[model samples]
Target: MNWQPAKKQNDYVQTRNKNFSPPTVNQVLQNAQKMIGPISESPRLDAQVLLAKIMKNSRTWLVAHPKSRLGAQEDVQYRRLVARRAHGEPLPYILGTWEFFGRRFQINPSVLIPRAETEHLVEEALGLLRNNRSVLKVLEVGTGSGCIAVSLLLEMRSLGVVATDISLQALRTAAQNIVNHAIGDRIDLVQTDLFSGIRGQFDLVCANLPYIPRKVLNNLQVGRWEPRLALDGGEDGFIYLRRFIAEVAKVLAPGGSVVLEIGEGQDEEVRSMIRLGFPRAPVRISKDLAGYNRVVVFET
Candidate 1:
């Protein structure tokens, strides 16, 4: 399943015939569209992104310089990236970075690529902490790319977060983001199974834990490239959710809040689990812009 540029002389000959002259940005977009249109939802946009990456320029620049020609090396790299995307590797993975919560973070197959839906989780947490200016400590379970934790640290000056993940590789990705954002001193990255090695209480505990059922994951395009530890939520997609509810009480400060990103249609079930786990805590679910239940927040 290696995805590299076609290397055979015959392949090169065919490419040479197809591209007699160096490809202009517009021609490359058309080529990418033809190659990936069947699998990609927005083939033109995907082409623009890939070309932008190759040219080390912005998408806006691509749009303005459609007549500009790609160098030989640039054309080869663009084709290789397009081939990778056409084969189901995520665009963010191919680009090696993704924007989340208005900031860019380094990403790879080792961690789940941060999604726009997860931004709701960050917003909900920020809303809860807005008026509380006092020094706040937060615990983030399953800090994939550290997007949630780092975004929080950036938005809330009084906040400090301890982020944990079972995958050492994921922690490394998060670590790079921490340094990139200059939040290295504010975040502590630990490798442990959901709160196993964590200590102490915090003003808030948040997680975008794996909530996709094993069966459901098999059908997802994302399942092909993302780490299973970051996507598999066991048989019912609540295995980790239930476990977090069971153990979070120990490290959650009194009056501390917990926010989580849940899969679609699991809102009521997750809220019920929260009630059962912490009968005294108040629970509520928040929907994303499209109105799907996306985040669950509770206070102990």
Candidate 2:
């Protein structure tokens, strides 16, 4: 709630000279800071990082060489990037990469951006693996950027994974990420809604499904940028979630567990659904950093 908002860099540029180029990093940062002051509190920092990214230099260097000169071409490109940021484009999308679970993931507009809170799901999965030393089968539903699957493989060796998604585009992104992390051989990526074509029992299952209620999504800033299929849940926003519960019971092994990410206020309802669908399966919910119920756990 009190997080620092990154600043827009274009505000500093003189309006009369819309195309006026900043010839130095200091000039760029100063202009960015000026424009950013009214737009956001963290404009200076955001400007530095964006400029540094363009120059392939570290933030420290940007601060160290505030007076260092930038070439004509570099200034042109930096201004364009600054203009985009000024319009509220996400920095990660601009850079094309995001660090998740200690690894770098190529991120695009195709999937929901991986969040730090989801790391708890990964931690939960790791804890399960630790207890089940012989476990080798893992399944990840709605495997967005393949961050969850790739992170699991990086932690556990010789593990077999089945990552599924309903979006062909999302699957393609996940597939590329799986290969990028060199887990293609160990993990099989499939395009299916929930568990439509998934087979066999798995020792563990993980999902970060679309849980936002259709009504609420219309009111969120995330909806404006993220793909709707990756965010919209029909009506109460539990459509995919309900389907996941029914399908999970059929594919999960006895005594195995499934970890799911739930929307802010849907924890109790999701737990009820899981309980009704998997009467024998035990259910639990975990909170996110903000202490909101955010994950649903079911153990058979």
For model 1, how does the per-residue alpha-carbon lDDT over 23-128 read when each residue is reduced to its tens digit? 7898888878787787889888888888898999999999999899988678777878898888878888998999999999999999999999999999999999
Q: Note the residue pairs that clash in candidate 2.
A: 7-43, 11-35, 12-35
Give each model's whole-structure lDDT: 0.88, 0.81
lDDT of 2 by residue, 140-180 (tens): 99888899999999999968999998888888888888888
> Candidate 1: misplaced stretches above 4 Å?
1-5, 8-20
Which candidate leads the pack in TM-score?
A: 1
Residue 18 deviation, candidate 1, in Å? 16
Clash number by candidate, in order: 0, 3
Clashing pairs in 1: none
* Candidate No. with top lDDT: 1
